[model samples]
Each structure stands twice: as C-alpha cells, then as structure tokens.
Target: MGNTQIGHTDFMSKVRLTDRYVASVSPPPGGRIEIFDDNPLGAGLILRVSQTGRKSWVVRYRNEDGEQRRFSLGLYPDVSLAEARKRCIQARLAASDGVDPAGAKRRRISERRSRIIKTFNDLSLVYFAASECGEWKPRGKRKRPSTISGEKWLWTKHIKPSLGALPLEDVTPLDIKNLLRGLVDKGQDTSANRVRAQIRQMFNYAILEAEVATANPVARVPMMGEETPRDRVLRDEEIRLVWRALGDPGSLTSAQGARRANQRVYVSRPVALAIKLLLLTLQRRHEVAGMLRTELDLDQAIWAIPGSRTKNGRTTFVPLSPGAVVLIREAIRLADAGRDHPSAFVFPARWDRDKALTPASLTRALRDVSKALFLPSLTPHDLRRTAASHMASERLGISPLVIGRILNHTSEKGGAAAVTLSTYALHDFMPEKRSALIRWDKLLSEIVSTRL
Candidate 1:
C-alpha cells in the first residue's frame, strides 16, 4: 500500500508500518490501518482509524468454550480514550456473563429518555367540550349561570386559549410571560388574573399527578390587585328611591324598582309575601324561594327548609316573626286562589306555572329596577351588599356574624354557614337574625314611609 501523509507530522497521524499490519492510510483520506504490537499475533488490542477520523478498538480473545471472540469498542476520540476502555471492560464482562453488550447499551440509553413530548392538545382532547383551535374548555350552560359561571368563563376564554398549545415540558417561564403579556395588552386585567389562577392549577396538576416535570407556569405572574373598590351597596337615599320605585305600576323596571326599592317588592301576591318574609326573617333568597307551602306553619310562626335546598348542605329552621307570618299567610291566600292549579308554586313562573320563581329571579327583578334608571349597571349582588351594609350601619348592634347567618353566607373566619336549612328542627338562629332583620325593616320602613 502507498503511504500518504495527513496534515501535520507533530500529530503523528500519518501511519508508517510494516506489511504484516499494513498501517497505511486506506486511501487519500485518513484511514487508520491496524495499530498493533510489532507482530500481528501479539496479545494486545488493535485500533483502526477510519477516513472520517473515527477510531475503534478490537480485542481478540479466546472464549471459555474455546471459541474466538472479537469485540468492537466503538468509534472515538469523540468517545474518548477512557470511555473506550470502559466500553471494552463492559463488553468483556457482558461476553463472560453471556449478555449481548450491544443490546445492553441500547437498553440503557432508551430507559434514560423514554418520555415523548405531551402537548396541551393531548390533555385537552379528553377534557375539552369544544375545539376552537384546540383547547380543553367546557361550554357555558346558558347565557348566564349564576356568578360562578362568570369565573368559569374567565378560565376558559382567556387562560385556556393562551397557553393551551405548548407541550407541558416546553412551557417555560418565558412562555408564561408571553401569554400574560398578551392578555394585559388586550386590557383584560380581571380576566387575565383569573386565567393565571386557572393555569397555575393546571400546571400543579401536571406536576403532581400527570407526571409532567414543568413548574407552575403562572407561579410568578403578577396581578394588578384591586386599586379601586367599587361600591355595590345602596346608600340611604338610594334605598329610599328603591322603596319608592316599588309598587309603582309603570314598566317592569318601575315595578321591579318599587319592589326592590323597599323590602316588600314583588308582583305576585305570594312572591310579595316571600320578599316580606326574607326581610322580616333575614333568610336567604333561596330559603324563601324553595319553601314548600307545607313547610310553613303560620300558627306556630315557623318555616322549615330542608337540607337539600341549603347552601351549607345542612337542615336549618327559622322562627317566623309576626311580619314573617303575615307575609306567608298573604302568599298562601294568593296561592290558594289558584286552586285550579294545586301544584302551582307560591311564586309561580309566568312561563311555567309548575315551577317556583328561581332565587335568581329576585336578583333579576332588582336588575330590572336598575334598568328603570335607564340601566345604571347595578348587579343583584349589589343588593345583598346593600343589605349587609344597611345591617352594619343601621341595624341595632348587629354582629357581622349575624349578617352572615341571615344571608346564609359562609363565615369568612370559619367554614360554617350560620343559617342553612339542613336540620328538621323548628328552632334556629332565626330569632337572633330575624330580630336584626326586623330592626333593618323598620329603618327601611322609616325611609320609604316618607314617600321621598
């Protein structure tokens, strides 16, 4: 074989050897012929450097079965001298143990990185109800589904749309930043914050249960926490206006206003009485809405609400004041007048006589009242806030707990809702909360009595 020199002599790359080994370049390229001991049959290893500069090691040995075994230690100096030796050792050990060294190496590499990338698209396919460019968001039950529905919308509309395409592993800090920045740019601050919260929950699920290694993408997302608190309560004068607007036979807005303006606001006689009961007893809108006519004992001045209708998932009873008794009796009288439809509710729906007006109906009625002011943009929750504020300001020494109890609101300090209808027992916190309500009614009465 003719010899050809590689670039530099100092590197000792060009081979000069005798014919038994023939350590010449294989071609014009950098082929390494066998580098061996002086004799080809020596007991050491041989290295062959290829034209591509890859060097592999081969050892010639005799197996215990008296067969010849030759092992290739793999291409290198990329593999390194130490790594080649390690591979040789592993190959020798595997051959001795009757394991295929090549197969073992492949298995080790496959086990280390066996996971495939999981995109949000995969998780969403199982969870999502719609496919507006691949998201896992559920559809709205209706045009409106109580206040919780709005929270759900915030999660689906903003957060799910933004980061719902990235693979769980690819969702880095920068990805989260970009998503939130895009939301802020669109002036959806409140919605952006809500989306951030929901995304954080998704990432948390991904980490703990889904076995994805990404940290919560929204862990560091900033919030423009409330800088201005919008007032939702009806002021003293506005309370008077709401009462004045009640009972006024004009538009539904006017009629609803008159009813909501004061506590005794309702069009249907039974519904009117229910409102009166809500005011006198300070019972929640649902407790009064869901009351079966049978649950009321007018003679005993008591109303029993079953646990199924209660928010706290418990049975509670409420003592009816004289005012409460008067209201329910009036409702019964009106409901009795509809004897042709015995199944008719106390506040029967105009569209469906079998169903009682929903608890939401009262709030909707108040919104109608606000619409009389050509839509002042007040919400029904504002009315509840008004009730609380009025109790705090005017009711005689009423505790915040009493307000919570009457409203069936869960106590902020504790998990208990003070006045839920879970118990079949007749006596409950109604006496205390009712007393507070009656006091509130008197204040409202005083304002409305002036006809201002």
Candidate 2:
C-alpha cells in the first residue's frame, strides 16, 4: 500500500486515462498522490497532479499489442475520486482478461451506433453513399458525379423515406413486400421495382461493411406482373389518338378515367415535349436526362451517349430526326433556369439539378402524355417495346443484331458479338435502320392522328 495521503476535498470529474479517474478534488501541483491500495497490476486508479493544482485519473494496463496501455477515466474536481476509482476497477478487470479497455469502449460506441433507431431516414445516408460507390469512373479509378447524382436521387426520393431507419437485422422480406405493394397501390411499378433493387443493394452493404449479418430481405419480394413504363409504345391507331389527344382535352377522358388514372397528370408543354422525346429517341428516361452538350453532333445528326454515363455501359449513337434535333435544341434552349444551366442532360430533374432527369419524372411525364393523348396506357419503356414490335413487324423487317445494338440488349445467350466478329460491325446496315426509324416515326405520327 502507498502512503495514505489525503485526496483533495473538492469534487472532480477528470479522467487522465481509461480505468483511471480523479475525484472531484482538483489536485494541487506536483508529485506523489494517494492511489488505491495493492494495485500491483496497475488496476487501481491514479491521479496525476499538475502545477496548476488540477488532477486527472489514468488506469494503466497491458494492451492487446502487449504494450502498457493507459485508459482515461475523467478529470478531477469534475469526476469524483470514488467514481474514477470504480471505473478503474471495471477497466482493470477488462484489461486483466487481455481485453483492451479502449476496445471495450469502442465496442460500446459501436453498439450505441447499432442501437440507434434506423427510421426510414437514418439508413439513407449510408445507403446513398454505397449507391454512389457503384457508379462509373471518369478515366478509370475516379467515379463520375453524374452517376453519384443518379443514385442520390433514387436514395432521396424513393428509398430513404421508404425504409431508411429500420434495423439492418430487423428488416424482413415482408417489409420489402409491403413496400412493393405500396408502390403498386401508387401506380408506380417501375419505381417499386427500382426501390426493391436499391434496398437489396443497401442490405448487402450493411452485411459486408457495417458488420451487420442479415439476409437481403428485399431480394425475396415479388413484383406485380407488369412493370409500368411511362413509355409504353403506342400502337398505330393508339399513337394517332395519343397524338390527336395531345391537343384535345376531351378525348383524354378514357385515359384520365378511374382505374388507371394514376398513370400521370400534366397540363404543360414541357411535359408534352418530354413525352415526344421518349418516342423520338426510343431511350430510357435517364439517358435523355443526362444528355450533355458535347454528345450531340448536329452536323452528323447523331446524339451520342458515352458508355460510362449510359445504363447499358456502352456508347450509343442515336440517329436524330430533324424533328428530334429540333426538339433537342429547343430543350437545350429552354434549359431549366435554376441549376442545370451550365452542364448537360436534356430533360434535367429539378430536385437533383446536377443530373439530367429522374426516372420517376420521366415515367410520370410519359404517363401523362399517354393519358392526355388518349392512347392505351403506355409506359416510357413501352417505347422500346414499340420500337421492337415495329422492327419485328412482318411488313418491314430489321435484323436482330442491329436491333440489339440500338437497344443495347445483351444477347439472350450472352455470347453474340463477343465470339462472333461479324455481328459487332452490323451498324453498317444504316439504310435499313434509317428506313425503319422513318417508318416507325411516321407510323407513330399516324397513330397519334387517329380518332375513336
């Protein structure tokens, strides 16, 4: 036992190290201090007195690395000596077992982080960050901000509020099912599917990085039969009616009626132009949204989308119609004033000004176009399907490879152009492609010209 020197009378709450804490008494400057008895392994708390008469406790013990470790308990005069001593005892017991007191403290901190209630908002930050990490790099190692921007939109608009704060371990398949069902109820099958995918990705991250061991609950959730695309290609007469309906508010009664009413709602030209662009380009919404100024070559009449920015991860050449080019120029001319002023993206989304447009916004606009034009409930994706249908038509036929390249579809067997060199250079069949697009566009225009 050390000499029984009296501790300072004042209360203290200072800890100089883990396992060691000084009592409320702020020790006066200097030397030897009263320490707990028989602390041979340095288990008892000890306070170091400073020149200014302040004291702090430190608990000395061996660390995992076999070196001496000191743990801070609290400052003297703030943390009472008794409490500091008690903490030192606990820390000593921890250290005696070769358990680092600091490590235990870290575990407690991690546990607290885990215990934090993850509401539909809490997991969003981590979820979005993980989402951003999946984007394409500019040259190779660095990621593109546009990709980051897209993920951020989905995470913010569709994901976070939906299932952000749920405990990673607690989320279940049923929760995902319910979320899908909610999207179904909202007439957003496309968004529902997207949310489902994003959730699965988030869970995977939680499992891998956050030390959360949980099955991907969202993976098991099933979607309704049809994924609603705001760009459903209009049939010949359907296109005509849709086109005619664009100007006629009365003919849209059927589209705007009860059961399928949630498709979309719009009463503006920007919305109308958005619908037109989907058919004109036969593109996914995000593609058009992220269109850049440098991508369009008016002289060559091509709208080139870089492989990095595209969903398909390949460069795409869109043979622009004179009408299409005009529309694009108008779109560029009418760029959103607030944020999308400097960079590109044809139909920029307002919420995330940095990216072109959101999938939801495109879907919504397309749905409104269909409903307003009095066409069969169409989706943006249906534009591609419609293009496929026209290409598959018996009257005018286009080769599958050309179609595949244009739409960026991976081969069904996944071994087409890769092993077969001839298939890769098939875009030389341009006369056929041009004729087909012209026919398809005219057919669509005809479809829009129809009536009941």
Which candidate number maximizes lDDT? 2
Off by over 4 Å in 2: 1-120, 134-166, 172-196, 214-233, 247-267, 336-343, 349-355, 372-375, 411-432, 442-452
Instruction: Estimate, for each residue in 93-187, the C-alpha lDDT of model 2 and write its tens digit.
Output: 88777889876775675566466525545555654554457532323344455555656777778666656666656667887788678777888
Worst 10 residues of 2 by lDDT: 9-18
Put down candidate 1 lDDT per residue, 114-135, tens digits, no spaces: 2432676454433222223223
lDDT of each: 0.55, 0.61
- The deviation in Å at residue 417 for candidate 2 is 5.0
Give model 1's TM-score versus the native structure: 0.46
Residue range with the least summed lDDT across 10 consecutive positions in model 1: 138-147
Candidate 2 similarity to native, TM-score: 0.58
Best TM-score among the predictions, by candidate number = 2
